[model samples]
Target: MLRVLIIAQCALLSGVLVAEVSAADPGSRPNVLLIVVDDLNDWVGCLPAHFRANGYETAGAGKIFHHYQNHPSSWDDFWPSKNLQFPPTHVPAKEYQPAFDRKPRPRNWYMDFNWGPLDKVVEETGDWMSMKFVSQKLQEKRDPSADSGQAKPFFLACGIYRPHVPWFVPRKFFDMFPPDRIQLPPSKADDQPVAAGPTQLREVDAR
Candidate 1:
């Protein structure tokens, strides 16, 4: 089942990264290679049901799941989930931030339809580099079961950090798609229907 989440920013940033690498043994247990990328919307390719599914069991993403029991390792040991814990609890950014509160810069709306990297780019190394390293090694990296003599399945997770803030991308990649070749997204010149009546009509008389 496909699911979409629309934040306060209208359209969902719906990019996901999921790839599977299994061994030859028909009965071999799967070893998960989890490379979890963050902040990317749904434009990434071959993204399985990740935002919803938990772990290497099968991907599907909607929210964070840290239930270790669900994804046991080949050793039958429970894995621990880690988070970037700076504070004990969540606090308003304006209140807690020391130097750059919310952020030093404003969020990119991508309204200009601009191509290529920003003047001051965000992702310097680029996700492609990271993905290439992980994608190539999944098969070779799988652990062998001591008794079984077969390669175990594994989850290879990689994190793609940008396309979020600065919307930085390398110029060579942008050149692949020329403006003339690109097709515009469908649109309606007129206003579309809305389920919620305008606040004006619902609350006050409009002269």
Candidate 2:
């Protein structure tokens, strides 16, 4: 029987293998569903609620030397990151809205507060077309009638690119973290300033 386990944790870890079929067998490998979110460092809450609820949050980069390695035996076959390709250039809409619908910032931002359903962000942004591709792959399921009436188990890995931009997250997410309720980083009196060039003074000062 095919069983599935999805590791929703931030780290790209391949957990213990439950079963190992013969490599020579036509059905040896488990059906793989891959997901790679580009520039996704912080926001991972876009995943299914159950997976997020039981997930283990870590720095995720604890070990630098062996971080992204996967067990060779985890799958008989595998595909590396697919969304590594750069996104298409974006053209702003004629009429623009800002986050919280508050006011559009002078600098263009992908996500600010024009909101709708959760998946609406994926639906609307052409730059984020990769999300729709991943969604379609997720929808494809094994047909029980085909394949000798036996359904093969699958190993699906879904990566949510929430923290990554163009931010385009739902409006509810913005409401969830209003400016007042947000936490600011503590300023340290002993913080040291690095040397910067005259040309980069404005950019460095902003930091």
Candidate 3:
């Protein structure tokens, strides 16, 4: 019998769920599945590596770490490999539009900040590809024949890189919230200076 432990870590939410197998004899080591979002950037030490060293197969897919920072030894296998850490961007059709004016911005601004509904399907995105890879790993019931050939515990990590920047989700999601029914909080003039402070600084730095 095999036991499973699911650890879900999203933006600000962290949870652990222990699932017991139906068989009477529980396995020695329980498989661990860690699902991370942008929070993966905060991981200084790789938990998967620790588990790997302790006789568990470790595998990962997607943005487990920041593009610049990666612990290769952490996983026995990983998607996109080391050479191609950041996957190709998914460009939508010409008809699909951006939320912003698409005007030139200052170099000081590192990440592109914008929001809009994409005309493209979710499957076209790199995240979806990584998700499919991880999904395949999760469906594996036993180790490969090259290995011990028995049911082996594994430490699997999946990183979802959505709800972060560029906010270009599929139109289906946006349609769920009708524009007419949406509401915005009351705004004060006093808050404008503080809110626009960052933008002003970027403009000044560019010049």
Candidate 4:
């Protein structure tokens, strides 16, 4: 089943990200797949609690919720576990080395601020691992061993952590669009200002 969420300037209340899912098939309990993304100009909500409360089995991986406000009760299981919140970075935290050529800048979260080709394979990254886990779950069949003798409809939320920051993508993707062939979008000084408020309050390196 396919559903689209249209969200605009909506606040997250009671630690739940709420949004309307349109075009759902009537009278059928279809499995839900909630794919949340980070650093995108759009926003969304948490529907796992509601689905679970209504007899759905909830599971999630990656950035389903903000790293700090994860709701463990909302999910039957979550990736990176509830304690870890986020998956391990492509580069281990302890072994990370910052750019020495540029002057040190003060910031709240400074790691992974630089971008370039990663020396590692895509399979070695946390995002790839999370995706693999989700794929495995999707392919799983209902277990007859359950007490109910049947499996409940699943509400799976997969959070993709890319196109956000630290664009250490594999060289192949970057190679597809050569820098010389890239064209800049037209802009004007008189254009209306972009969305700004609490969302844009933080410092992010979107290079």
Steric overlap count per candidate: 31, 3, 0, 3
Model 4 gets an lDDT of 0.54
Candidates' TM-scores? 0.27, 0.28, 0.57, 0.57
Model 2, 95: alpha-carbon shift in Å? Answer: 11
Error of 3 at 131 (Å): 2.3
- Pairs that clash in candidate 3: none
Q: Provide the lowest-lDDT 10-residue window in model 2.
A: 57-66
Candidate with better lDDT, 3 vs 4: 4
Query: For candidate 1, what is the lDDT?
Result: 0.29
Candidate 1 C-alpha lDDT tens digits along 17-80: 2212221222342222121222222234123223223333221111122111122221111112
Sorting all predicted structures by TM-score, with the top scorer first, yields: 4, 3, 2, 1
lDDT of each: 0.29, 0.31, 0.52, 0.54
| Per-residue C-alpha lDDT of model 2 across residues 1-207, encoded as one tens digit per residue | 112222222233322122221222214432221221211212332222223334422111111111233222223222233212223323233233322234333333323322232434444443345455445444554433455644444444433333433344545666677769888787554563331121122221121
lDDT of 3: 0.52
Residue 72 error, candidate 4, Å: 0.9
Worst lDDT 10-window in candidate 1: 1-10
Best model number under lDDT: 4
Ranking by lDDT: 4, 3, 2, 1
lDDT of 3 by residue, 1-207 (tens): 012112222211222122222222223322222323223324433466557767888877777654334467677878777445445445332333321224344433324443456666878677888888788887663435545556558887777777666556788889899878999778675677432433433321121
Worst-scoring 10-residue span by lDDT in model 3: 1-10
